[model samples]
Target chain A: MSTASTGKSLAFTAGDGYHDDPPLVAGNLSFHEVTDLVALHTEKKTPMAWYGAFSIANIGLMILLLSVAYLFWNGVGVWGLNNPVGWGYAIVNFVFWVGIGHAGTLISAILYLFRQKWRTAINRSAEAMTIFAVICALLFPTIHVGRVWAIYWSLPIPNQMEMWPQFKSPLLWDVFAVSVYFTVSLVFWYVGLVPDLATLRDRTPLTKKLRQKVLGFFALGWNGANRHWRNYEKAYLLLAALATPLVLSVHSVVSFDFAVSIIPGWHTTIFPPYFVAGAIFSGFGMVMTLMVIARKVYHMENIITINHLEKMNIIILLTGTMVGFAYITEFFIAWYSGSPYEQYAFINRATGPYAWAYWTMMSCNLLFPQFFWFKKLRRNVAFMFVVSIFVNIGMWFERFVIVVTSLHRDYLPSAWDYYTPTAIDVLTLIGSFGLFFTLFLIFLRFLPMVALAEVKMVMPQSDPHFYEGHGDGHGAAHDLSAGKPESDRGKS
Target chain B: MLKELTRETKATMGIYEPRRDKVYGLLAEFSDPGALLHAAEGVREAGYKHFDTHSPFPVHGMDRAMGLGNSKVGYITLVGGITGLAVATWLQWWTGGVDYPLDISGKPFFAWEPSIPIMFELTILFAALAAVAGMFALNGLPRPYNPLFYSENFSRVTDDAFFLHVAASDGRFDMEKTEQLLRDLGALYVEVIEDLGTEQGPAGDVRGEAVEKAQA
Candidate 1:
């Protein structure tokens, strides 16, 4: 279960003269051990560090509440909104939060369908992150509408005069896409939690009758009947299948909000895929940022091992490269098209007033993740942590570059102006992080952060042939890929 | 003859019911999924119909071992998806094209190209909804009580233990013989599950009666 590879060569498996494949659950713990370890976080006395982190998060939440209240009182004019640069920090933050939400669905839905057993350990908390990020994302559009009271007019419902929202607008499409994504992701997350909740219910002491009853009610009297699992597993597969496309479509629709417009920077066919790639890049960054701390604070190193972090770093490398490719491709197309405005937009992004923001994005997103190509650097906890922070910042700048740089320079030179975020804009952005972490900390304290039931199923003991002494001759010390259930094996 | 007829009528009407002390089934515990799966296959091969295996997580190939066909939840999901597609199409067409048409920038009203995102979202939304709902419905979840809960050892089924329950309702059920059969199939421990003092009726009716008793 050691995460360190001893082989001199970079090989994937032990059989081919390379170091052994690192384990998913590093300690070779039993099912009971896993259950106890995860449940302890929720059942035990609150940790001192948890109190420290929670207070910090609460301060952020307070700031968010105050800033939002101020905005509502004074109106959108209080923030920095000029004539040419209409879309500002509000749109940038909205996109940033939504991008952060994608990692959860990717880990939960896409990875499950691909039979990646390593996903079991982190999927639960990652999905929780997705839900919280979406909540923060939804806040922007609602408050940015200025007339929050009349936001219902955006729905399909007819107003007093029978006029409906413009169906052709990408803005309305975004509403439907994001709402459905949230709803489906919630159901998927809850369905996965049922069995784990049952474990908590069963383990509750006699004195905590209230806690037991609450968990039991939510557990829905689950008895782990194979008849139920037969349907439960099928439902899970179906949801995963549905969510895979749903995740892809959600961000593509968001991109359409920009692509459908006639702006030189926004009106490009590659925007959909480009945006989707950028989203996944940023989402994984956020996941790493939280997970690095969560595992250490909760003493979950065995469950979420260095091997898991290494695998995630590889993904970051791949997606970061894709985003970088899109950045270059945009410049190429601008030059190839011979359109003066498109050329100017791309040139201006690199050499104009916002050149500092553009280069910061390049180095943080493109240059920093390149370190992950070296196995040692990616596996080093401190190095990945710093890169993840850079990823978060760079992605925000990516959105900023897309929204402000293009809008600041319109067709007329007289309309050109540099847009800077006011104190409110900066406070609101910081406050959104406050909202995300507040909900996340509460989840960590209350619910099982790791998916206990799913993790157990990935252990060697869950294999039917394991007890017969013929479990691939690996004994109990097998890696996660080796411990995959029989039903998953034959398919591939 | 008249007395016999009255007794039959009362039994049918649920007025005459068996005592709660009756054995519900034989509950068998296994050390791991392998043994439990082998026992499931043994039970199925023995032609025992009302038997089920329990564990913390779903065991692979369990359906085949227990002689279960593919789950019917997919059919429900398919129907839900189709309904969503239809509804989304109708809503967009009626609101934009037929009801109150708009001529903004000379774009057509209710085109399928622009409507694809909404349609796709709704399709996934409804399918996911039906999949979860149908799975719960098929599994008969949220039942306030089950006779299996009467066995103290069965509590571990949600954690480290594996279990098999053969219902007394099975046509082939014989209390002593089934217990022996489970032991032969290598159950680590076995116990007789009994229906304790609870309402002896449909799950819904039992829930209603229990709630009333609690309120009183």
Candidate 2:
């Protein structure tokens, strides 16, 4: 690779026909240098551990697919859907997957807007995880509706029956919210992929024509021009601005599906914000869980640095605190509302048939993230990974508590019944993990796991003021020119 | 008649020098953008077509200072947004209205309220798509090859250097006079540059031929 300048002069004239030597030393990393780095990460074949993980994911996927087939053939009764507990594992999984998807957009878009440079390495993979997780989430809702074919009816339009979907229903709101969230997230992810796709297109073997064509189509003819870069940046900034509000609104609306209902424990005003915070908290935990393993596997510690992990830890701690506050607020409101039904619901959650789930939720979400408050603990990747897994388990338990605990002890004591997950329910939930991992593995094999262009932009050599070379060959002229007042030097 | 013309015309000539020492000197030398614009206007009115301005960062109104027109990005975004809204609406109607019919939550199949989120998403999606497409269309992306790229020093655009090049194609180009003008305008160094057209076609042709031969 040629690292030295090719001894070419660039002219700048004040008036027509006058030529000037290029003012600054031009330093650029060759295409070969960039490719070498990419090859280092991607050239290696799938590791033994990845194979093991993939096999496990495959098994889980098999179970999930089989269960879905059974459910479709035999109806919702194949799981544990009864009168009092109509929504068991399906709704729980739906919320869980949705929560998992939240952190990707938050890390990529929200952090990007704040100019957090640490996000460059992890954002690509994290966005891929978001898309996959949302795909896993969509499954539950589609199946939970029982008549899977009738799913289109949720969309709003004037039908042949001359009727309109009731706008007041939260489920209808969910149909809108989830679809929008998914579409925007997909666009955001694909747009980010364009530059990296071009990078791949440039480096791939000549024989890989199909790969080139596919990547070329996706790249949409990006050339890294200044004008293209300027607009690319503007569009990205605008998308980030748009996404922040959408992330908040989508989760809040999902929470409304429960909160707007007359169920004593679910019908709280604090549900929306509480759910959003919990979603972010769990989402960050999931990112950490995946990233710790990914960094070790791909040897990307320099790019996905310890500093990035620490930042994520801080967010986890903050959201954990918010979740703890919401839990306390719920209890206080239940007492303050003075309605016997509401009061009973809280007490039942703590001491009822599924008290274990409630306590597990409290400890996992509230207690585990507290460890991150210590700088040492936050920096410990092994410890962080363990805590992240625990947090995920804790969040799943939290949803179980919310859905089952509230519905089990309704206003009418005669109608109250215990909710239990059958074998199919358990298999389906485990299967979702398989689906998530399968998609993630495929992404890992193909995509540029790091944002290479964004990283190059941040390198120190790219700064012209930092380079102390003038057009003249002599060193003293450059220093004497540099002797201009500090404020005037490179002032624009 | 020539003597009378000379008497009537008081020549107020302004000279410009390329300040090679400081890449971003042009930005700081001018007091403000307004002053820069005024200077540009003065030069234009005097029928002196050989001048340029440089800045470390993209200065707002600099295009207008150089007498360039507004870009067409806005128009592209608008058309894209409208198209997106229409497509989203049409897709919803086709799938939910025409293709299948089933009641959800005891409500009519096609609910407009639920469609707002998709509508908003599609609008943004279209706008963003248009923004990037319009940018590429106007600026000509994927060029992969340019005369500027052949000049190794042109990489300074990505770095801290700022520059303005008055092309040789300009009608008033005079090497000695332009150099003197640049020096008068406080340019530290001025040099003439040769255009080198780097050949890159043989590689493309070779690749294409190899593919064809393999297929054969």
Candidate 3:
């Protein structure tokens, strides 16, 4: 019975060889211990180390707010968005940040659908990343509009002007797409938080009535009723199912902003699939970057194991290959079409003034990910961190090349001009990261950085019938008939 | 958490008094899932319809033990998805075709092709939002208070212990009998759940306890 099909035997015992080697979660944790460990982050006194990071992140948030203020006060013209290159750093940053958010949904929704148990370790933080990344992303379009006050016009709300956003416009589609994606993500994230919030509520000593009240209010009076779980499970499954399509459609619509246009490089049928793949690839890169630091700083190595990192690396490799293939297909299509404008768009991207940026995209996305093929490199935290940074940088340049190159030299040579980001343009891009990291750091400190409820669910100790108390599922890994769980590890 | 909880002794004070409206239910705690699962079956077998099993996370087969039917959240989502599709299609068709018909490039204003993306997104959005709201409604959530909170031992319900609570309002519920049944079924501790007593529920209603029982 090809071991894979006999899930009863191997699933709890041995997994894909990678897991058998070092277990997905170490330091065998019981239902109670896991709760204590995970909840400790939120309930404990603020560590001095946390304050150090928080201060740095606050400075970043301040920079983000100032840059946004500048953009809104001066208008879209404050950036390098001119007549010929109307879509500049702003659009590039918008697409880049949006792409980074996709990995979060993929981990929480798509992985949940596929029943990837490994996701239990990383889903909370990944989802948090997605929320913050989207928050940073929402800023670009608002500032890009020039009239930030009239941003509400982008929505199909009833007003005295009787104005309706043109349904034909992809920009209008983007407004719907991003907003819906954000709302769904927030709901999904919040729903997952309820059970854990209850845990935090329960853990709060009666002495701290204030903390209990605050946490209890949001916990929604959850007593972990079995009936409530039944509904919660079904609701979560439905949301995951709904979010699965959204993860795909949201990026597809974002890709439409370019593909619907007549611009040679932008108008391609392969754009949707290509953008989706690129988004996952880049998003995973950010996940890796954040997770590596998080696991180290939080002493979460027991839960966020090396095996988990390896699985994510494998995905990065797969998506990176798909992206590289998309790049090649774009070149082939440009040449095959025999349209001089398309050919020039492709050729100029490589050999023209922007070749440096083009090569940066290629090396970071295509070349660096190849290193992950080495199991050792992929498992090495330091090496993986550097490589993930490279992937993110390359993904950013990929957008820059696609946006700037296509618009810098349009069909009319007279209108062609070299696009250069003004100081505001550069600062705003940096400020978006400032915004993303600021939100992320706050989430890390205040919220349960790891999914407490989910992590407990994965523990064999949680099963009523299993008495095996080995922290890493080792006891159950031996026999299905193991009865009467003992406290294998002493109470914390 | 690191301060070594000053209220650590909130475990149980023995024979918890049910001070008038303060009583919510009889909460029986089991140290492990095996005991809790068995106790859940006993609670169901005893015909206690308004009882539930609570643990740090969901336990396998606990639903069957609690005798709960499949959740209706999925159906709610389906209806919500259809509503969104209808709304999106109707909104798009009316706005583009009838309300403000501006023929730009001779393409049909209500073309089905371009509308699919919005349709798909809207359907997903509506369905997802419905699922969450429906779940919260079904579970009677956003509730700031539950009498279970008054039992300090119940806090471990989210940590190490597994508990089966039989509400005081259940048709089969008699406090002494249910407590006896639970203790016999391997309960490490049995504590009476008491309310915060911050508000009264229409004279003798016991609002928090009444609402939870009424759902069952």
Candidate 4:
């Protein structure tokens, strides 16, 4: 323990030491680098595969819009909404979109708080996914009211009509919850974009003055100062902390829309946490589906990285397991609680007229993510893509099971009636995919897919050690006589 | 004019000759941050201002040794949170209270329990917005240029380098004395830095230069 004249130990301590090696420069794509990206998007024209996908999406969107128009022009009676089964595909899609929106907030907020560096690569895209998914979700609830123009009547304000929204209604809670969720998520997404927008502002050679002005305004004149970096980091951390709870609460409130009801399967204590887990599971699945396509099309494999995809797969697996657990626990509780109605509801879900949907939900949400337990399977992009599709399918069925199954069979046996989707319902459902993809495609074309500044922060070469060895015997003294040369330290 | 006037005044006042302080020691490099932090603490204890430590990354305790205080971001977040809560309550009250009231469900109007979700969301919304906005405000962002970029050696910040700069701005900062102090504090190299007086250029050009330097 010989202390140097500097009054610090000169001996090397292996575990307690801090290695300040330079950040590794994997590679960076600057603004100029995006020319290749633009070329791929535009000059490549529409590939035969993309053409098919786009056409399918467009057709779906058209059908959906047409159905919506029909609903608005005609009424809710256009679809199969009779006595017992009031809610239909519209509500199902709303829940599904809300669930899909979960992955974005989870990726941006939860993972960010944990200081998961891999999040930098995928957060931007996921945030966009959340926003778009929410938009898609809002459509269903708005149209589901039948009288779309009278949607404002649901608000709590004292009006000339002398009416006020019911304080106890779960639907009203949804109104506030979803709106607030959307607003906060939007702000979070925009704030995150500020630094990146500045990067883009500097990078894009927009000859048009309006483009420059608009970009400049959005960028908020970010200069990336040290003080700015410090504040930005703090703000980002705080936001992440705020958002973490919001993510859990929003979906739980959505679950309350069903759980608060006395309608057998809908009224369960486990719905909140279970819904949140299922939301995350399905959301991650959507992320996987989108990421695979985006990475391949944009040729951004280096930035997106295998590590990111692997981490996402892990999340999918964990959440999928949680969903499976919830499913089991719901059944077990129903049987153990000795509630005949609960038992009947669970049984009806499995062996009823909509048993196909129930099984689909079970296999897709539970069985697909299990493949990720194997490293080889998790690494297989195509396999993961398939699993992701299955997860989506399962999540859709989960909503279907919650809605259609519960309503199809009530306590009053005389009121029980088989419900089936009209062709318009199916077409409208297909059109939602079109709406989602169209928005996504537009986003991909314009926005920076990757958060460049955040990624730069994580690169190895950004470490301070590269400048440590300059000057005197001080370098030798600091090396702790571990016998490793300065050159060797630099190499490592 | 200011420099000449200062020199003349110093000569007239007969206080021109500054006291010479000599420091002597062997300087070393710190590739490991723990060593750098230890050295920083040692220097701080020794009452040295002309010495600094460099590392490839920011060590957890390094700021304390460097005499930095806790970041003020929490204050911003707190204010943001309050604002969010207020706004959320107000929005719900206004919308559900005054904007439009309908009896869709057979429940009382202006429900507070359901409003909790919106309240929670707004709080987070404001808090997050404030955090980001506060960060930009505090950090003085959108500054496209910095004086540090003039030094080619500063590029190592993005790579592997932890540097403690003992600028002339410090009270103990003298050419020889600072160099000797750095030597005593285990600095591997102590170099005198000159402030490049190119402040009169157009802001855009300066920004371009900074960008070019960063890219380089």
DockQ of each: 0.41, 0.09, 0.35, 0.17
**What ranking emerges by lDDT with the best candidate at the front?**
1, 3, 4, 2
Q: Using lDDT as the measure, which candidate wins?
A: 1
Weakest ten-residue segment in model 3 chain A by summed lDDT: A1-10
> For candidate 3, what is the DockQ-based docking class?
acceptable
Q: Judging by DockQ against the true structure, name the best candidate.
A: 1
Error of 4 at A167 (Å): 3.0
For each candidate, give its TM-score against the true structure: 0.90, 0.72, 0.89, 0.73
Per-model C-alpha lDDT, please? 0.84, 0.66, 0.80, 0.68
Q: Give the C-alpha interface root-mean-square deviation per candidate.
A: 8.0, 10.5, 9.0, 10.5
Model 1 clash pairs are: none
Question: Model 4 chain A: which ten-residue window has the lowest total lDDT?
Answer: A1-10
Q: Estimate, for each residue in A49-98, the C-alpha lDDT of model 3 and write its tens digit.
A: 88887778777778878888977777777788778899998889999999
**Residue-wise C-alpha lDDT for candidate 4, range B106-187, written one tens digit per residue:** 6544667767776786787778767766765555544334334333444333223344554343354455654554456554
Rank all candidate structures by their DockQ, best first, as comma-separated numbers.
Answer: 1, 3, 4, 2
lDDT of 3 by residue, B1-216 (tens): 732232221111011223467566887767566667888898888887667788878888888887777888998999999999999898889888887787878989888888888888899889999999988877767666566665656667776667788776566777778878888896766776665565654212342332221100
Q: Which stretches of candidate 1 lie over 4 Å from their true place?
A: A1-19, A470-492, B1-21, B197-216
What DockQ does candidate 1 score? 0.41
Instruction: Please give, as one word, the docking class of candidate 2.
Output: incorrect
TM-score of chain A of 4: 0.86
Superposing all C-alpha atoms, what RMSD in Å does each candidate have to the true structure? 7.6, 12.1, 8.3, 9.9
Candidate 4 per-residue lDDT over residues A333-385, each given as its tens digit:
99998999999999888888888988899999998889899988887889999
lDDT of 2 by residue, A312-336 (tens): 9999999998998899899999999
